[model samples]
Target: MNLVIVGLGAIGGSFAMRLMKQGYDRIVGVDIDEETLQLALDKGYIHEGTTSPEHVIAEADIVLLTLYPGQIASFIDENKDHFKQGAVITDVTGVKTSLIRDVERLLPDHVDFIFAHPMRGSEKKGIAGAEESKFKEANALITPVSSNKEENIKKVEQLYKDAGFKTITRVMPEQHDEQIAYVSQLMHALSVSVVNSTQASPDTLLFAGNSFKELTRIADINEELWAELFSMNKDALLDSITCFEEQLDVFKNALVNTNEEELKDFLKKARLQRKKWY
Candidate 1:
């Protein structure tokens, strides 16, 4: 398969690398950054690298976009005419609902845009930060509409599996966004908030426990990208934030009243939910 991966940052570079390791050889990496393209080439992540995708995209059987959530639709719209007929285009962006809604109509009638999220990545950026191990055993979610071709959907699933994802779950776009708001985006929001909340000396962390470090590890975020992401899914994220606030208030009330039973109840509820995942 001639797979053209656009925006060769960490996710795209890692996708190219891992898929190549799996023996998919006709892989091309595209990025506006000359340095990133060179890095991917030097690392052998992609068989070919380019600064412009106009020609490669036209020839591709599959295109994997790892651009920011906001840039995705615009990129597709600008390049839709170049897409090969029946080509399968998928993405690794976290948000889905609006993207699918926007691009599905703009895509060539013969082409398919299969929306997906890889469920994990590093806070680090660039081709240099790409690592195949990041996708190991990670959950990959495919948000395919009923109109999507069964063949294209399967191809997207196999692509994620080949890249080292252990599980593939199909979800509707709306449902996917809601769940992501709670699990992925909400966690990032909490981490960023916690890290920014600190008014203490920087060395305070030196005296802190592992849990604090672990909890806030994701706070070193890509601000522009995440701001676009949060804005794209504003309603769902706002709902998630409100729910979190309600729960936080429960903890605060328990502490203020010194109500041991209520505190135990809060812990018990959380434990039960955590146990469900385990």
Candidate 2:
């Protein structure tokens, strides 16, 4: 099976290496960045490299687009004509509702555009940081449209399983994005805000506890990519942020009013709610 991965960064390069190791021969990589393409090839993640999306689509049986938010549709529309017949295509984009509708509308009838969001990533970037085991035990959410074939969905499930991921299928694109905004995007925003809010000096840094360190772990995020994701899913994220702010306001009010009973009640309820979360 010929598989081509576009945007050979951390996720793409790691997936390519794992699939290659699984005995999937005929692997190709396409990336606009020559340096990244050369790095993936040098690391043996790809058998060959192509700077042109058209060339990769022409020969690949399956294509994985790992581009940034809003970039996938343009690539698909530009090269849909070159995609091999019956080829199964998938994406590793973080947000689903952001593009799935438009992508489904534009893709050729013969090609399958199964949407997937593997719930795993790192603060690091590039093929140099890629590791095959990164997908292990990671939760993969597959969002398939109506036109998606059952067989094609199964193929994607097996591919993730072989790469050491545990997969679950979520049919609707909007549902996928809504869930991701809460779990992934909200957490990143919280971390970034927490870290930025604390303009601590060197002396204050020495006083940081383990809890503070853990809470702000994801604050060192990739700004460029994450900014795009936040912008694309603006409404959902804004709602989440607004809800969080309201909760914070309640806490602030309780503190200012010196309402011990209310504060205790709030803490108890928060503990109970957190206990129910997985």
Candidate 3:
């Protein structure tokens, strides 16, 4: 199948490489950056590369949108007419509610847009940072609206399976947003706060342990991309933050009151819950 990957950044580029390794050649890449497109070609992640969506979108059997939420909607709105009839379009966008609503409304009837988010990534950006191993044994969430065709949804599920994801889950768009707000967005927010809480000296960082480094790894984020994600899912993210703050308050009170039992209970509960997660 001919595939078109929009936005040749880390996620997109990694998808391209994995798909190529699976013997699905004829992959084309689209990006605003000419340098990135050339790099994708040089790395053999794509057989063809173009700076304009209109140039290669029509020929794609599957169009994988790996751009930010806002950019994905805009690209679909502007180039929906060029999409091949019966072509399946999927995305790697983090947030989905507003994006799905907008793109589905503007999408032509001949083409289908099935929203999917691969639950894997690094704290790095661009094609240079793309790694095929990121998708190995990772979970993927496929969010399909009521209007989505059943066949198209299955095709998207298979797409992720072929890309090396270990698990593929199906969820409604709003439910996906709510869950991701807690599991994904909240962690990024916490990481940013932890990194910014103090202006640590280089020597201080040198003395840090694995826990500190792991917790703050995502703090080195892409501001422009994450800003869009945080804003688009503001309500859910804020709710997660409020819930987190309430839990933190309990710990604060326990420490302030010198309640050893309460502190132990909190730590014990956390360890038990985390055990269930693993």
Clashing pairs for predicted structure model 3, backbone only: none
What lDDT tens digits, residue by residue, belong to model 1 across residues 1-278? 99999988889888988999999959999899988888788888898989889999999999999999888888988998899888999999888888888787677787888889998777888887888777999999999887899999999999999999999999888998998899889999999888777565768777889988988888999998899989999999999999999999999999999999999999999999999999
Over the stretch 1-278, how does candidate 3's per-residue lDDT look in tens digits?
88999988889989999998988858999999999999889889899999887868889989999988888877888997899889999999899998887887788889988999999966788987798776999999999887789999998898898889999999988998999999999999999988877676668688899999899889999999999999999999999999999999999999999999999999999999999999
Least well predicted 10-residue stretch by lDDT in candidate 3: 196-205
- lDDT (0-100) at residue 68 of candidate 2? 82
Ranking by lDDT: 3, 1, 2
Per-candidate Cα RMSD to the true structure, in Å, reads 1.3, 1.7, 1.3
The positional error of residue 120 in candidate 3, measured at the CA in angstroms, is 0.4
